[model samples]
Target: MDRGEQQLIDLVNAWAKYSEATPDADVAGFCLHYLTETAQPAVLNQHSPVASPDGLYDEKWVESLTGTANRSLTEIRPSSRLAALVGRLSKYGYFYSKKAMFPLNFKSIEEPVYLIVLAQMGTPKKSELIYEMMVEFASGIDVVNRLVGMGYIEEFPDENDRRSKRLRITEAGLTILQECFPVMNRVADVAYSSLTEGEKALLIQILDKLDRYHAEHYKLSKNAGFDEVYDRMVT
Candidate 1:
C-alpha cells in the first residue's frame, strides 16, 4: 500500500526465496530468532522493568498484528502455506528491526530493567541473573533504581525470602506495550504486502520451524559464543 508496506513485502518475498534454498542455514534463523528472543531481554533492560517470563512481545499480539488469525501452517493447504509463512517471518523481522532502530533511552532507567521484567514474567517466577543481562548487554544498578523512581515498575516481595524483592509490570507499564502495538503493526504490514499469498505462507513455515528448533535447543545455545555469533549476524 504505502512505501513502508511495499518495502516489507519485498523483504519477506526475498527472505522466503532465500530460506527455501537453505532451510537448515542457521544464519537467517539466528538473525531472526535472536531478535525474537532478545527483544524481551532488551525491552526489560532498556525500557520498563517488566520481565516477560513467557517471552517478549506476546505471541497473540504478534499473530493478530501480522494477520495470522490463529491458524497453524499445517492447517493451510500447500498452495497458500508459503504466503502465510512469509507474512509471519517478515512480521517478526520488522518488529525487531524497528526496536533496534529506535532503542529506548536507558539514561534514566538502568539498561537491565527490561530483562528484570522479563525474568519476573517468565514462568515459575524465576529471577533473571544480573550476569545474564551483562552478557546480553552491559548494564548498571543506577539505571535500575532510576526506573523504580520513574514509576514504570514496583517492587514485589520475594516469596522465598522477605529480605529480597522482585520487579513486576504495573498498569502503566502495560500501557506502554499497548502504545507500541500500532507502530509494530504498521511495520509488519510494510514487510509482507508484496508477496503472493503462497510465498508468504512458506516464509511463515520456515520461521516457525526455526523458532521451534531454537526453543528445543535454547539451553545449550545460551552461551557467549552464540551471543557473539548472533550479535555479528544481526548487526
Candidate 2:
C-alpha cells in the first residue's frame, strides 16, 4: 500500500481502539486522542491518576480512596474534588508568595499587587481600584492607608470631583514592584513545576473558561446572599 493509504488505515485502527476505550467520547475527542498518541507521543495522557504526567500522585494511594471508610473520597463528586484542589492550591500559592514578598518589606501579597494595579491604572479612583481587586471596602482602604503610610503610593483629589480621591503608585512603589516581579515569577515556577507544556496549555484553556464565568458572576453576586447566589447561579 502507498504511504497515504497506510496512514489512513492506521487512523481507522486507532479510532476503533479509542472508541472502544472511551465509548462516550466524540469524534473531536478521538481526533485529539489520535494526535496525542501519534503526533505528540511524548506527551502522556492525563486521564489515569496512575499515569499522571507529573508523577506526583501515587497510584496505590489514589486507589485507596473509596468505600464508607475514614478519609474516603467515595462521596466527593468531581466538581467538589476539583474545587477542593483549587482551594488548597490557592493556599499553597499564597504561602509561597507570602514568603517571596516578605523580603520586599511587604507583609502580604496585596501591598505590591495594589501598587502594580494602580501603576497600570495610572491613577484610578480609590473605589475603582478597590473594586478592581474584588476586595471589601474596609480591607481595600486598609491596604491603601498602609501603602500611603509606607510612601509606596499616594492619593490625590480628582480633578472633576473634589470630594473623590484617586490613587497611584509612587516612585518608591515602582522600585519595589520592579523587584517583586522576579520573586513572584519564582513563586509561579514552583506552583507550575509539575505540569508539562501541553498540560499547562490545556489547563490554561480550562482555567480561563472558569475565570471568565466567575468574573461575570462576581459582579452580580457581590450584594447577594449565599443561597440567593446559589439558586441563581447553580440550582
Candidate 3:
C-alpha cells in the first residue's frame, strides 16, 4: 500500500485498540485526524474541516493532498478517501453482522449478500434500498448471484420491465436478521461508544456530506451509463 493507505489502515487498527480501551472517547476526532492528516495541506488547520463559505472544500486542495480530484470524492470514483474509509468500516460492520448472525450459517451467503438482503427487508422500495446500500457500501452482481444460489433471496421480474428484476429476502433471511437484531444493535453501540457526542456528530456530518455527494454523482454516472467509472476503484 501507499503511505496514505497504510496510514489509514494503521489508524483504523489504532482506533480498534482505542475503542477497546476507552470506549467512550472521541472516535470521530481520531478518524478525522487520519483523513485530515493525509490530506493535501500536510498539516490540517481548523479551516480544513470547515467547508468554505460556498459550502465545499476547494477542488484543488483535495486533489493536491490526496492525488485525486475533488470530483473523485463524489460518486465519480470508487476509491475516494471517504469511500476507502467507509469500505473499511463496512468490513468491520460485516464482521460484526456475521458474528451477530452466527450459528445460522448460510454457507453460500457472502457478507455483501447478507447486507443486501438485510437492506431489502428493512427498506420498502428496492431501488431506494439498493441505492442507499450502494452509497454506504458498494457491492457487485457476483455477490447478488451468490445470495440467489443460497436461496436467501429471489429476483422477480419487475412489473415495469420484464427484463429487469427486483430482489426480495426470503423468510429464512428475515429470520436470521431478526435473531441478530439485538446483537447488531449492540455492535453499533460498541462501535459508536468510542466517540464523544461532539465527535460523533462531526463524524456523522462528514460522512453524510460524502454520502450525499456520492449519491448525486452516482446518479449522473448511471444516467450516462458509465459502468467503468467504478471498475478500477473498488478496494
For residues 46-156, what per-residue lDDT tens digits would candidate 2 score against the true structure? 333223334423432343332222333333345655665687788788888888888787876777888888899998999999998989999999999999999999888
**Pick by TM-score: 1 or 3, better one:** 3
How does residue 30 of candidate 1 score in lDDT? 45
Best by lDDT: 2
Please give the ranking of all candidate structures by TM-score, highest first, separated by commas: 2, 3, 1
Model 1 ranges off by over 4 Å = 1-150, 162-164, 223-235
Taking all chains together, the TM-score of candidate 1 against the true structure is 0.40
lDDT of 1 by residue, 1-235 (tens): 8999997896676566656767685555645553454344434335333333354335534554468535332223333545556576656665554563354433312233353444456422223534334434334344445555756556777888777766665666566555445655555566667788766876687678877876655555566596775664455
* Clash count of each predicted structure: 42, 0, 2
lDDT of 3 by residue, 3-27 (tens): 9999789777877766676657586
Q: Which candidate should be chosen as best, given TM-score against the real structure?
A: 2
RMSD of each candidate relative to the true structure: 19.0, 8.7, 14.6
Per-residue lDDT for 105 in model 1?
35
